[model samples]
Target: MDMLSCDLDRTNEIPLYEQLYLYIKREIIEGRLHYQTKLPSKRKLADFLEISQNTVEAAYEQLTSEGYLEVLPRKGYFVMASEDLEYVGKLDVPIKTDNVKNESFRYHFHPSIIDTAGFPFQQWRKYAKNVMDERNSDLLLLGEPQGEFELRTEIADYLYHARGVKCSPEQIVLGAGIEILLQQLVLLWDAKTKYGVEDPGYHLIPRIMKTYGRDLYPLQVDNSGVKVSEIARAGIDVVYVTPSRHFPYGTILSVNRRNKLLNWAAEADGRYIIEDDYDSEYRYSGKSIPSLQSMDQKGKVIYMGSFSKSLMPSIRISYMVLPHQLMERFRSELSFNNSSVSRMDQHILAQFMRHGDFGKHLNRMRKIYRRKLEKITEMLKHYADKIQVIGENSGLHIVLVVQNGLDETLLVKKAETANIRVYPLSQYTFEKKYEGPPQIILGFAGIPEEDLDDAITSLMKSWGI
Candidate 1:
């Protein structure tokens, strides 16, 4: 009983029961209490803490309900075998608290967030139960290496109808996330392949290539996506791009450059293009441009997309559409690898797509994000004299190019002083510093719609614009 010490604050507004429960939970999480460790009886704890037995009983009941503690008939409450908690406690390095500090900001303009409030949890739960209810023997077995065939079919059908991508189910490869799929793609290619990435492209693409020890060149981007001419100049074999809507700048590849890039891939023996169509689903104004994979007549474009942005990041589901030329190689060489995603999750998502819940969710989110973007654009009107907005017509984030001549570092530091967080556009640039006007990327997807105006106003006030 002396092993567990809880200092109760009778003066604090929080209920004594809740404080005691939290204390025990923390002990369990931090590994101060080992698995199956006996806890003091309610009466014993009440006597030790100088509290009523009812308070101790209530705390134990809550902990028991949450699976942190278990009671065996006449025996005392014991901590469950929580492997997850033990692993977290054993980590040698400090857990990153960058995400934890997100709450400290009065206003957050984070770019890579989605509204989880609207997530179809109940509907997903229904499908999840259905998958288990059927108890199909097929589900019990390890799924195909590429992924469940039905899921690939559903993804293929959805891509064709939504993004104008034409592909057979056999062409799609599912992984836990795009990074895993990219690693597999890298393994499929020769080690000597020189990859070309857009100057201010998605940061992870180049980082992934570097992880595989491949040589990479950063091609500069203009009004129309990546510079296609630079591919020939740099003598690169592969180019990775976000052609549908470029990151930071949000420039869609013009028809001219799209054709030129395709030609470059076709002309060279080993040249290929990797089209990352992340966040292309949220185009607000004009019609969403068809994917570069849809436009490629030659078997050169390798299309990759993920549900993390559109659905939820925690789902860890992403897929890639391989060109027929590489599909053959992937089958013969790498088909033996096990799928990184859970088979149950794959089937549940397939059900979600087939039943049209996914499409409905996307439509609902598109509207919500569109309204958020509109509100952000309207509120930032107060700063129109000091800031020029770009890339507002599409995607989760909009670029605010400051006209006041403040450098990127000072602008971000100023925002932080006001408890506002703004992301620098230059951070996305690789190798070279962004030579354009000082800009910040404000992502509206994560921030609540009601908070958008307040966040923008905070930024304006912080900047003194």
Candidate 2:
């Protein structure tokens, strides 16, 4: 057939039969040739392509054996594997290749990156299949305005048990991510509200607030996290705090400051605190830290959590627990906005939690990350004199307070020269400059346990530490 357009490269090392087989296989898998389409006869194809008849016959035989085609009596080979072809097509996803112009590193310490090798893909696939069954047709339609009650119920239960966060499923709102939820919150709150954000904190929160023209005060951070007294001085209406383990620096908020921050929000009617409990799941030493939401006596804290770090980031499932007042306000004002997350994903995650897979996965990842952190500390013991480690008590990353005549910029550049990428703590700041000691952040979660030696060793060589 004219559609079987293939140029035979006789000079190529691959035999003509194998090449023809691969070409026909790709065409069938990619839907260029549909199910039940008849192929040219072996002799006819050989003549058209100026190849031997045996070559065409061998190709057709291979395709038939692989279930890509079927032959009927007196009829030619026809495409027979539609369902199998779909599965094969899905596996042929396009992989992105790196740009030759850009620099690629052997070791990268990206703080937000997580190891997906531990993901329960088999279990997730099972739940996904269950959710996609024809019986669950309701998932195809629009779900509840605030995510599916099933998923919210699971999230509420998990938070109550794991993080001591007290909230009903009704108070939880689900979205595609923290960014989407933050955007919705900016729309709900007053435009004039001055938000207080940590100076050396997760930069995205302040950036998101600024995008909506919300006034922001950069609250300087110390070893004990953000101070509540700073909020009073700035006249901030709201503040975003990471109480469990501060982002980048990993400073845990002191109990007294937590109480004072709660009091600060309670003192004013409109004042509230948004606790972003990002990456608190893996505490290497002691028990997992309880959330700031657990200490709120007044309805002033909006507790937000994401699966981006604890689970797979690509899932894009994030939820926020609203106080009764804000929950009521969201219902009355923001009810028109539908849930940003997919109903199918919600149902699947609910099933995953229902089967206790999520809890098990968290426990497994904790042990895995704990081993990696321990390996890192063990390997870096030799360089202890040159570098001081901080924020390794919890979370996936640790900050190395380094010296030996190297500034933050020089440290990063030196690591780059050694084919390793390390982050500087100053990158987290925007308005106010980071006045702390020169610190380089190394995220250990994505790094494998076996390579911890080489990675840390290479990094040390890079910095001459």
Candidate 3:
């Protein structure tokens, strides 16, 4: 009801605005400030606390940037409820604050979602401010067609060390998203470059392929990852795969399959593999698999990765590391094409990576996601007799095939009726529909750590488990 007033220590190293920002943030997070509560105006707070309006504005801006508060234009600042914990359950528990705001679902088990609750927005905001400063005016102009060289260099180095992807900065092409990069590839290559995709692959692949009118073949995926036999049988020229962690199923491509695929790529003149190591850093266990591009002796692998999955989706930073031939061809053919991503954002990201903030944030997120996975698996053991966890031993999402003879649609419906959303694995397929037992895909990343038990409990009860 009242404005935030904090005692500022002028002698302290931290700025006055930051002190006020922390105090207000604590009030909101600790539930001292009620949801939707409006704070005093910048001028009013400045006078009340005997601080400059600029200082008050800076504090509010920081809070707004970090998503702890919301600015409603002329309406002044209002609280965007950070009060959290998603649970449509039998048990009664007080809600805890999470990063999500303006929420809809009680529980959304979206496979593509990430842990936004723990994102390093503070660091990102700082970088963003520095990038936009007048000193970096060059970033305001059009950037290189492929992306900022500085950003690409950072990406190239990160990829080499983390995923064993061997590529120079010149080969890396940055785009707003994987879709845009895929569309670029479609436009660059000949129309007859038929593409083969893993069945139940990342949903974005088939859509991009068909949209561009490329001949699309649905390659089946089994325990060893995508079936190379199907690729050869289909006489496909290019293969798109997620070798590190397969989609929905989460199976890693076997070493034998990897070699066979490489051989297929090498055998033909135009054959190539597109490896989408989107969430490679989130691997929970086992030896790190070498990327397809790293293993390629020939210039036949086009490696693509995204910050959308590993980091916040809003970043919209995705990259492609092309073979030498394609890189040269791209430079010659698409020279006029400008960078899809904002140069300001690119430079900020480059700085973030160079300062090791990106790596540190990624490491912390991996640990958080890993813990969420463990908790979900452990909770599922309670329903072990009723559900079969069919997912691979790693990644953000898990697959559960119910013992009950219901179809995939019914499984999803049951969960939705109980205020929980569970995706059917069949929905992920492009051509070949899943005809197995009742199955659903649930991502642990979207669920808050404190809400897992109740969320799982409610979901199982909905299924009559």
Candidate 4:
């Protein structure tokens, strides 16, 4: 084993004994000193480091008291077993050898953090076994690109009963997830076509569309959702809107705007609409609104739905509901590209849905998530004067609008020092000249309800609010 090394600056303020204690403790926890491995004798370590024997003895004594090492009569000390440590490694070293030569990169929002601790692992295990136990030839073979017919059928039924979306099994085309569906849509649509995306919307759409050399117009949004009048005037061939709950802002598109937007798409001479109904399943208010796809009399909207936000992220399954007019073209394009979701996951999800367990699981999660949402709201309310908490009624995240002149960058840095994570809303915008109140997007769904109060208190102290 390589001997662990540390630099002890005599000029530094921290005591050498404490520094040595930390270093030795880290090594033992990292398994560098394996079970029953003898450490260097105190005199040898002190001589090598040019430090006194008493300091080395103090470090060893502290480590032994902390259960990182065991001392035997006259045999000196040995490292403990790996099972005794809570975490199995030392802190990761910085990537670069020289800190001054670091390069800067654009900031990106953190990925959605889900609390896996609360996942229904036992129930999922049962369902997984049941699926394999009842497996047949189709389950083992390459299934349909539109996904197993059984899953499509189950999804159609679930959407109808739960979200009031009118659809048949044939209309639903399953893919790996939202990104995959977006890729397929870009492939089906010609590269030269102009696509309209909401300003300050999900940042991924612009990046994805740009990769295919498609022209994009950043349509503006307000309290009612994406502005239909502006989108109509933009003269774009394709419009992508999240009507259920606007991303980041979390505003539902009003019924009037939804109808007007659909009418405009119909008048635009066969223009297409991509509706991303991503987290609409967890609304905590009045009845869930019917999707724009349900109101498409002229076959203008292509509905994309995903189970990533509803179920677990590992279940990379999402489906698109296509209009009958574009169904053949979509199928032809998808077949040429060979894009499809996993056959096994599709079968398992189908079985879960058919047995009515999927619905039951959703109901149970809704209750749990509702409680979490309330806790977050209560905490935000406690800081009402200093922070404006928006998007409280729906979705997994809430936006806190901070007062002007506050440096969000510094606040975020301070929070990181306390081990609390948050994201700035401006990171999602594409336009550089756009300005607004400083805001942070905090996700409560992934955090424990019991920790909500402490997390909020820590954030407040960090901000000095």
Clashing pairs in 2: none
Worst 10 residues of 2 by lDDT: 94-103
Writing each residue's lDDT as its tens digit, candidate 2 over 187-212 gives: 88888988998877876776687688
lDDT scores of the candidates, listed in order: 0.84, 0.84, 0.82, 0.76
> Candidates 1 and 3: which is better by TM-score?
1
Give the per-residue lDDT digits (tens) of candidate 3, residues 48-94.
Answer: 98777888898899888877788887999987676542221232232
Q: Report the C-alpha lDDT of model 4 over 15-48, residue by residue, as the tens digit.
A: 5677787787776676577888888788888888
- Could you tell which candidate, 2 or 4, scores higher by TM-score? 2
Q: Which ranges in model 2 have alpha carbons more than 4 Å from their true place?
A: 1-104
User: What ranking of all candidate models by TM-score puts the best one first?
Assistant: 1, 3, 2, 4
Show pairs that collide, candidate 3.
none
What does the lDDT come to for candidate 2? 0.84
Better of 1 and 3 by lDDT: 1
Candidate 1 ranges beyond 4 A from true positions: 1-104, 137-140
Estimated TM-score per prediction? Answer: 0.79, 0.77, 0.77, 0.77
Residue 355 Cα positional deviation in candidate 2, in Å, after optimal superposition: 0.8
